[model samples]
Target: MQLLPDSWPPARRWVQVALINLVVAALLGALMRYIFLWEVPGVEYRNIMHAHSHGAMLGWVYLVLFTGYVLLAGPARRVYTYLFWATQLTVVAIFVLFALQGYSASSIAATSLHVLLSYVAVALLWPDLRRRLAGTVALPYLLAGLGSIVLSTLGLWALGIIMSSKPPNMTLFYLAIQFFLHGQLNGWFMFGTLGLVVAYFEKQQLPLNRPRLRQAFILLLCSLLPTYGLAVAWAERHPAIYAVTALGVLLQLLGVVQWLRAVWPALQQLTARLAPLLRGLWAFGIGSLAFKALVHAAVAVPYVAVMSFTVRNFVIGFVHLVTLGATTLTLLALLHGQGLLSLRGRVARLGAWLLLAGFVLTEMLLFLQGLMLWLDWSFIPSYHTVLLLATLLLPAGALLLALRAARAPASTDPGAQPLPQYAAHSPVSANGSADTAANR
Candidate 1:
């Protein structure tokens, strides 16, 4: 399991490049917040915001998941290398074009290409991953993820039609976003991470309840389609839709709890092996997920659904809660699990802590703002400056992480490794510390 460059391990290069994307996206996000505070602008806010969101979603998240896939199935697949670089090209093109002019001719073309490339990724991955992953219990989760990705494309197509039409359907635009986000958060991100977690447990010869995990997966899949009604409820204003969506939200919550229970024992085992910062990531990431499910289900009430969409603070806070709190942290944990991030040394430790601090502070500010709005405070003073400064921590941490990766030695080692792949299966004590053999 030693790193070798001649072999061109996809884990090293792809993840390195992905971390750069993460830093860039964070910088773009910070810049957006900066303008909101100071209004210093050469570039348009909306256009740059487009770049920020697209870069964060496609550039960082998609690329990281692609790296995780390669890690799980093995890096010997050639199509993966092709998909990796090709998608990077698309991401760069979209980000540049969007920053210059939001959804202008070039940006529109790039967006179209991004959608096509996603399908291309799935097409290239399915045959190869399915083959190598055969007979593995986690294979279904992986394949379901790919399928969800392709299914999510329907939203992009819907968006394109709406945009191209003379009078764009504004309602459909939001609906499309909901479609993409729901499928992605629950389908691609959750399933992919779950598969990797299961694979890690398998490597450790840990016991898992496959039936329970699969039941969770199935419930999520069933609930996803109806959950779109939760978003659509804003426009439709139908009580029946609210009822159905409430049921879907409840099901999603139940499914997650089921999956979490199945993983709890393994997570306790894995937690003791992780660095403290990484352990914090697992705690916050999974904790936010439970919070999200509860909040999302709360929208089963018709008035709450409208408020969630209409209130700027609530909207932004929830979106960041999903992207940064749930997806980003989970992705970081999986990346570390896959051995791409060393997660040792002061540099890595500092970077992780800074990112966590940034996230917590930003969340606090956002939640406070939302509280102000809910309580009829009209607005919160100095909110913009506080948010802008808080946002800076994200990029600062991301940059340090990239630097730490750059400074790390070419090959990883045995005893000095972070979360060694085959650490002894000794039991963990009640205090969450590993026993002697596992620690050594």
Candidate 2:
């Protein structure tokens, strides 16, 4: 019910547009997957893929962050809306131009414009968000997320510089992409969204192990920069970088363990109160974090490191795990918890389930293919068809979500009953005591 946005033409449109963008991105992805069977005139594979990824990142993820911030934290300065539109325009331009020409002058200009807009976005939004720093763990993570945005620009600039030269250092180009990817995926989207989730708990006065929460935060925050080495390890065979990556892996594992121990119980209790759809979303999202930490640990190994990056299927599968499973679902849960989506609403629930199912299937296909390649097994027959079909559900879900989101009532029913509040000092079941303590 009117949870996010206080902007012109209704804040709800922001959400609707964002979801619509998601639908478009998913469609683009599906098209790419299916292109093998159906050739589209004048379409380039890499160009469309660029649109797919950039659309998801900038159109969906970036816009959703803005929606959540305004929804949960309340209104900020006037410049917020202006920056929001400008950024959206740039994203659209890049997506369209890239489809026309891969890394051409037009797309590059649009990309540079986006990078500039991103800087302004962080600058305008950061001060307003500092209040989020007062007590909850969310603020610091958000700050780090914004910092990642800026740091990513350095990579962007570096890549631009090299691309202009007679012969670009391909390794350097990849390093630039790595910096941007790791930061955007891990730093900005993951941390920022997770922080908001914690803030919601704090707001609800939910039980948590506050000390462990702090530990997890510290461990993860401290590990963030060093973890860049994992991305760097992709290009560099330097022993020192690998060693640093190993350390980052350990820290990440510790952080994740601390986080799970601290919040898992509270989360369980909370999910018990949530609707089935919400629970599924939570399962997809939070569970991905646990699995991702384990995967990161494994990937950190010296033997596995090269394969993780070198294998195209592995790379695609891994990226989707983060984007669809972890980032998108977690943010969706946040939206539902913020009262943006109806837990019992048929359209929303159906859309969420479809998205989850699609993600699962897509990952399955990609990983299966990767495994085949790794073991020297025969390729999966009609692999392209399988991926294409799996990927289609993503957009299908997004379309339903966007349609219903657009039709969503401005607010929840006036007669709707509110769930009983769980006061900070309230007693939970014996099982939850440890978790409640984490909130202290």
Candidate 3:
């Protein structure tokens, strides 16, 4: 049996980090429920929510994407391993301190350390990316995503420092949240996921002309416009700015429509082989567009408080649907392409179905929650319980799928790669030279 290489240690380390964060998020969620629903005291629901959100969003989801990106970009070997360990240590220290002693000066110190280390990890990728840019259509998008990460981290660090020195101001808190949300949603998740799609299509040898590439870039920028305006409006408290932001959001919706049109033909071809998974991706994209429309409407009519609900569902619901669901599924499909998942068994198909079911069910719960809030109805206690239960099951199915993939033999095919356009060159021989330029 060929052992997993020590040179690729960072990817494995990231997987471990993701698992740890998943556990931590779950524990924090349970603790919050016990405190609020079971009458335990001294455990702030908001704080627990903060912890859960950070662990899941930054720790699990983003880390997973980071790992996949690293793997696809070629292993970093030593440098990334060091950065990964340092970042993980910082993250764990901060979270542990927060969970045990509550928020404090020391916790803030840890947060600062964590932020610095994370920025370092993100920065380390710059050299690697610089090396990989030749003939890659997705390179620009990935670079832009990384740039956003830097800005987001800086914003977060600034907010943390400010909060440490002053009393809580609602406006500052609101601005901070907006900054963090935009950074994650538009900057990291959308940019990263779409970059990967570009990479995948490239690897599959799908044609990408200059015009299509330009459209993709425009889509990304359009997506960020409303978010940028919203940030400005929140910080400056300008009604006109808010109106303009709503207009920007409408443009973003139009951009998404254009994007879907451009990709429709390619997606149709992929449908025969990737039916269920592609369907999930479509659902996620459609849901996200719906969310953008709702948010625009909510902004247009200030009387409606449903914007929060709409935004939350968009972030939590559709974002995860694409990030955790579609992206992860596509990664698995890539792994399977590399013979990391046995394609010969019914077990793999079963695992896929289970995962798909989990995703659909979870999205249904989110949709129901949004509908309730939109209609000005109170959600029942059971609804929250069901939501949690569904969340738990979804990851459980994902874990099973991952394990099955991990147990399979690695592909020996010289040409087995992610997608055609993503493959920079033909597979390298033992001498690190191109072996053959075979198509997928």
Candidate 4:
């Protein structure tokens, strides 16, 4: 098989880097667990956790997805190969430097590199993304979500620099975290999910116009209300601002309901073969809605007893469930679209079932743990271990799915052709490349 492409050289590199980082992160996690089991004291768990988070989120998840998009989405004027490689290099440097030197001068240098590379990547991809939105009803919402990513990245970069400085201001760090959280949770994850759903439904010739418009409105409201309320609450430190934020939270919950209503008709028509993946996405949406509601309830109560467990559930249980579970499922679906995976076969079906089970169990355990903590109940170390072990199923399932995809034959659609064995031989136009290769 042809190996390299003149225009997509970075695509392969990106995948390789992402996989390496994932492996490293997993190894680090294992090491940490072993050390903890050995009763190591002053083990600097927090720093290791930071490394793991950075590696997994930025290095593995984002990089791999972006790389896949580059390879599968085909050539666009904006997305040159060099820029992609530079961005991955910057991300890898950030993780390595952070681990070696802690959050200091090296971290600042690495963060600066990442910021610069991120800007370049965004600039390069903006034109193609804008083209994709040309006549879509949800164009404005899509643009707004893109804007959120830009704003969030800037905030994240600022946070990184601040974190690297000596005698860091804890309050500023907290504010930075808040900004980072909002940007990722609201701007990137939420918008990305909605955009993907709309895109997929439209491609499938399913009814998406109404739901797209409705979701756009809800997301717009969600973007504005909570942002304003959170700013006011932070500035004033008043209970009233909290209440207003809670109102915004309720609005978000309403948006979720509207989303479900919009998609329910299409979901109802899914074949038995597609049910598992569809159900996984549905679970994610439900979890997202529940999380939003819980946030509102927590804000209203504001008492430690009532708020703590709810807050943890929203953050760790709900947020993570939707994020890790839904996002992965969506990514897998997208990959399938690219002809990277087949939804048919015993292995594929078993993998899907295992993944769904793992996600549900892990999320449930996480919520249970949060409740235990809130109630000051006795810790169940064994239960925690089981949860961690259960999480392995997700990756295991993913690996199996990947193997299936790798073994599947290329699409035989009349309009489609097999992907060029070499990147250099691939068609330059997105339509020619994608539609000629896969229906997705």
Candidate 2 — worst ten consecutive residues by lDDT sum? 413-422
Model 2 bad stretches (over 4 Å): 1-9, 407-440
Q: How close is candidate 1 to the true structure, as a TM-score?
A: 0.89
Q: For every model shown, what is its TM-score relative to the native structure?
A: 0.89, 0.89, 0.78, 0.76
List, residue by residue over 325-397, the lDDT tens digit for candidate 4. 6555555454444334445567775776666676677777877877787777966678657766776666666
User: Model 2 over residues 167-255: C-alpha lDDT tens digits?
Assistant: 89898898888888887887787777777777676655567788888888788877777778877876778989988888887898899
Model 1 ranges with Cα > 4 A deviation? 1-6, 378-381, 406-440
* lDDT accuracy of residue 254 in candidate 3: 62
Candidate 2: the clashing residue pairs are 4-71, 208-435, 208-436, 208-438, 208-439, 209-437, 209-438, 209-439, 210-438, 210-439
Error of 4 at 222 (Å): 4.0
Where is model 1 poorest over a 10-residue stretch in terms of lDDT?
414-423
Q: Name the weakest run of 10 consecutive residues (lDDT summed) in model 4.
A: 413-422
